[model samples]
Target: MGKKKVSALVLATTMVLLSACNVNMGGGDTASKPADAASKPAGSSSSAPQKVVFWHAMGGSNTKVVDQMVSDFNASQNKIQVEAVYQGSYDDLLSKLKTSMGSSDGPSIVQMYEIGSRFMIDSKTITPMQNFIDSEKWDVSQLEPNIAGYYTFGGKLYSMPFNTSNPILYYNKDLFKAAGLDPAKPPKTYEELKAAADAITKTGKATGANFAIYGWFIEQFFANQGSDYVNNGNGRTSQATESLVNNEAGVKTLAWWKDLIDTKAANNLGRKTDDSKKAFSAGQVGMILESTASLKGLVDSAAGKFEVGTGFLPKPADAKEGGVVVGGASLWMMNNKPNEEQKAAWEFIKFLTSPKEQAYWHINTGYFPITKKAYDEDSVKDNLKKFPQFQTAIDQLHQTKLNTATQGAVMGVFPEARQIVEGAIEEVLNNKKSPKDALDAAAKEITTKIQQYNKTVK
Candidate 1:
């Protein structure tokens, strides 16, 4: 959703959706990952029913649910006939969206990945949701603030969250018990996590940990340490013009990540989180970091084999300030469409966020409901009773200190920046460069990309 050709030099491809699409499993890559669980709430349009085209990137079972929800919406009213089209993965959808920029045939509403927010806002092809929120006096208080915070920029909400998630620490309890370690005691800090990994490795039962070399995890680590990913309040207060990942927080994170693999306590699973997931489920690894949306799948995967334990994402022992940022994608209403079409899409959007729909979404898909009221639903309550692992994510989310760091960084070149960071991490982990050297070079490249992006968006 960029206006002009943006940075992708490091990626060697067009800016693909390396966004939090299920973060690939729930928000990772979106393809190899399980289907995204998302639900929308209700609103009504008294006007004549119009054809509202919704483009989404959901695949597998998640796609079926999204389609069913659309069917339900279509059946419930005649004011809006929504054609929910599956536009491949987030990567494919983004490519298609960019190509369809000048045409009026694009979707009235599109579900874009979270990291694409900055690009979407700069493209000026989408109408900011705040316009409708203010015009209708919608009480957005019903939405979760943490989820809402990621979509908010320049003091306005740019998109409506559809399927949202955050990362958590997943450990194999059976492995822990086998190693004679307390299964109840998952790691709380970097040092503790390392110790636990060492214990697990030393026991010869399983490897200690296997965290994917994901830039999102890197960003989360920075947030956990109360550090910024870029300048200007993580690009919330004003336009970001530089990279901040080469600082002390970044060096420490990369160094630790490399050390974990180097010391043989953790496995270097490369950038694919699914490999780590496989290792954890197979009892080859004790702990892994992944999206909360993976709860149901991880539980189901480890069933009959081991007990799965959920804990908050690990941070440095000294990290007392920052928290996690919401992963997953959101609904952006296109500005190219008519006001009525946009309004119809809003009705559908409202319906998706409704407490009833959200409950169904959470119960079936593992995505945390966007609305607080959804928790009150009996079905949601029942689902939680069945899978208490969700409580860990809930507790972690509530415990997070809302700040600029936790709000997450926004940059038009974010996708490229993430890829660049991964390249830097790989360089250090492969012993090609020192942590500071790799990061400094990556930061320089990201800064150049940011400057290019700022020029175009301005």
Candidate 2:
């Protein structure tokens, strides 16, 4: 059989098995561990009604909201409980999962970034959520088809969506006013952005703009041009592993980035700090490309003195404005445990991603809502009037092509791939090499690593 057909068959079987097992998927008062499974005593049970442990990286004021959600879930339920744990950022969570999987103790549910999808699949340490959906005969219709595409492997959902976000253009109104440009208007195309950057730089208000991470920015750039960052977003669409980073689209995007740095309209800082955040916050940058997750931070840091506006990520002059990919993370269920623990984990997953849960998360954390129902919620609709930047994500999602590239980038060695690509961007900015040559070198190195990964995985 062909690779695609083989993968499809595998997915179909998993779904069939999942549907055969009858289970109550959503967490509620009646859903609990079987009597024999509830052998341990509860610790520090608060008023909130069964406490499943949830480890995530969403910290700061947003973490409080997660706790509140737990409290509310517990109060609403008499059987299953949720315990929220703030476990560092996405990278930290991956490392901790590695350690926890080796031992007996691990959180029932863990938060994972888009890249984690590969590791979770390789380890076979995560429960395919499609199983839970089928087992309980849950209404999958409530979730969008594309949302499942990001978390699925071999045709099954391995994780539930949570705290999802997308990239957008954040322009400084104060800079626009000083540049004699319309404060309400943001650059809608790459050509317009370059002109705006030059105009804004001439005003001496601040630098042109900053990108949080050059590689991620480049990925968005090509995505907007309808090019895949990595082989059709890691074969989620097809099994091809080709690299188009040296193509005309990629070369054009890379050259534009180099020009921005060469003209002194922008500065190249590694993704070490909130490059854009610090630049925009300190009034050193007039614009930035950043994740929608940073909306709250920008608003809070600006202190209402500066006007912050957001727009869809711009595309190349000739490209049909493709949409940006989603950021943030998802909830992954760990394997290597009893079915009862998995059952409990699935319950928490559903609870964390339900319409009510997603609405609360989007509003509280500034992450984009993963479900369409959240958009229908009056609370979310009302918030859009006050913080319209939040709606930029919705607009982008609608325009997005729903393909691998715009859905998300998939690379088994993504963390390493990013490091190499960033190094190339730096080389171009420093005049050490032309954008084409620099990316060519980086691509060669990355291709070697990709081959190594294929060998290892095979």
Candidate 3:
């Protein structure tokens, strides 16, 4: 690629304020297109585009892939520079955004998880993407149905969906064979899964299976059952105003989870996600309910030592698994910046969320592509055929519903609520509390939080 240039006009207005350091863009510029660099403003620069600081929480190989995308975007244009800074985990990024934005020292762009959507929506410090969409006349329909709803809030678009993933069932085929089960036939329902787990355990070949993030798993379960976990149309119509976790449907879901744990069909395995994964890799667990994003790590960790099979999460008896909610995170445009800076941020956001970039990101990060066009591409399909794990997630994607719960949950204190739910689940699993009691307590705690958040936001 030829050297891209940066516009002097953009450089004069844009400043990258990340960490405690200040990076200034000199008036002297290079001739580069806006698409070339991510961290820099896109007008035209002759020298290499100035870096636009991107605060992100992606780590491991996923981080490398994001950095590669930044590089790819940089090489494609000359007007702007994109600087991707690893900002620890999701919580770390949230902390940084909350603390730094008040001082105009936060990153221009940051990655926010799905759970953080409500928090961002409540914060007046974000530049809603709706304005940019209107200005650029970009097609929102180009995004994949399963993911598009996640970035939308109360009819306004605030973030760009980038890394999207869903929960899936990962089973060990060798364990299946030992239990006289067909490796090709994975469980389609909760009942079937229980039977499989029982048979696998009967052979005394492995420890019982486990699910990572039981709360997330349960949320998908409720969404599949057409049950709402909160009021206000599950927060799609209005912000969540009440708790639904203690309702009949939710009670049934919790009961089933309790039974799963009680029967030893699945272990509670508190959320050291990697430990549960390690158990699976060591052939100590026959089945694992893990995020689709963990597929890459599981595959690599197994290293051909076990036959791995991935499938959609099992459905409840009365309802088919409708749509697995999108997990992972998104990119938000920070407010408090000048109009020119916001425009430059919009350009970078557009480039990052483009179909081409989404496809590459999906392949590299093992997350689903956020655009249907990317998944429908010949290359993507061919790769899926070759890699069955990838195909399993794609199949699940097509079967999703776009309602609030399945589309994505929205609540002001979602992360806090999730932590509360996680603790309750742990208590129930450890036999310290009944499922009903545990969830009831969590529900009450979350409801108070929801009301508090509503009051605060209002």
Candidate 4:
């Protein structure tokens, strides 16, 4: 819970990195300058398949699935051949992309994290997906509204949704049964969740409910209460100038979480998601809140040990049935390419997002398919039949309303803001500060960072 102090040299190095990349830590309008085009290889033939390069940050099992998807796309047609390249983590990819954009060596398409949307748009190194959709008159009606809502800004789809995920409550069914709670009925509200955790812990079936001290859950909890994460309509209508995490919703959320930990109904698992997941899978914890993307790992880890059940993220008892925000990365097309290359990249993107491909991706990686029609695909249907727990995330996405709060925040400094919020959560959880005090301090710090970033970009 203690804050780590950064040395002056480290801070200076970070500033240099940010400045070198021309990255504004706060949201801003798109740049007016055009992107530089990569030169075509000499003597390239028009009749051959146009090679399109794609840079992604997926690793481990996700890398395997993405590789298979790319291979399948290449084998499916001859008009375009995509070369999917692994580019390390999302932060690494973003850094490399900034360097590549400075020259004309960037990939035709890139997988950017949701938090990077505002930065990507402002960089003006990519074309909006809406342009392609409008030009082709493609019907995007099949895309999930909730999934699309996160990447859409100002009524425009900026990127193609892929590998979308939402947070869900994963509970140990056997623990619930042993605790005399209904294994079939999971908690739906903050109060209910705490009660169940308390009962389970008291019965000694498990230690308690546990979750990572992650900011994404805080964001979801705010959305469930229909509260904006930042000003200017969650940074959709205009640039966000400040954070609202110190508001009533935030205080209530952090207070409830603090109470749970204080009463020994939950454990402070720190910031590592895997730690909490391991605890849950090992039956050390009765319940956990994690991304839907973890469904496969949880199920596999709990095999022959216990049954894992899932439900939508818990909401406030008095709050309406507001929804959770979408998480995960999206596919973005780089601009300033030759017509053939651009078209080829678009074709590859279309193939990747198609129902069949998305179904395969969903089944293989446990990520939710962005397209609604993918749910009806035989593969997805079969997977759902095998693991009905995955259905909760899909249903949660459907129930979500396309509001600004649920659409998520769009600040260039969003990644930094998340870290700040997580630090505040640690402060409150460790009793170093009150929820309001901790959150207020974090909001102040984030506001200063946002102001400083906007000034540099301007």
Residues 107-204 of candidate 1 have per-residue lDDT tens digits of 88898988888877766577778877886788999999888988988668889998888999999888788777799988989998988898889988
TM-score of each: 0.90, 0.84, 0.86, 0.91
For residues 275-301, what per-residue lDDT tens digits would candidate 2 score against the true structure? 667888888888888777778778678
Worst 10-residue lDDT window for candidate 4 reads 1-10
Off by over 4 Å in 1: 1-48
* lDDT at residue 168 of model 3 (Cα atoms): 85
State the C-alpha lDDT per candidate: 0.82, 0.69, 0.72, 0.82
Candidate 2: residue pairs that collide: 49-74, 49-75, 50-80, 50-81, 51-81, 51-82, 52-81, 165-327
Off by over 4 Å in 4: 1-45
> By descending lDDT, how would the candidates be arranged?
1, 4, 3, 2
In terms of lDDT, the best-performing candidate is 1
- By TM-score, the best candidate is 4
- RMSD (CA, Å), each prediction: 7.9, 8.3, 8.5, 4.6
Question: Candidate 2, TM-score vs. the true structure?
Answer: 0.84
> Once superposed on the true structure, which residue ranges of model 2 sit more than 4 Å away at CA?
1-51, 144-146, 237-242
Error of 4 at 219 (Å): 0.6
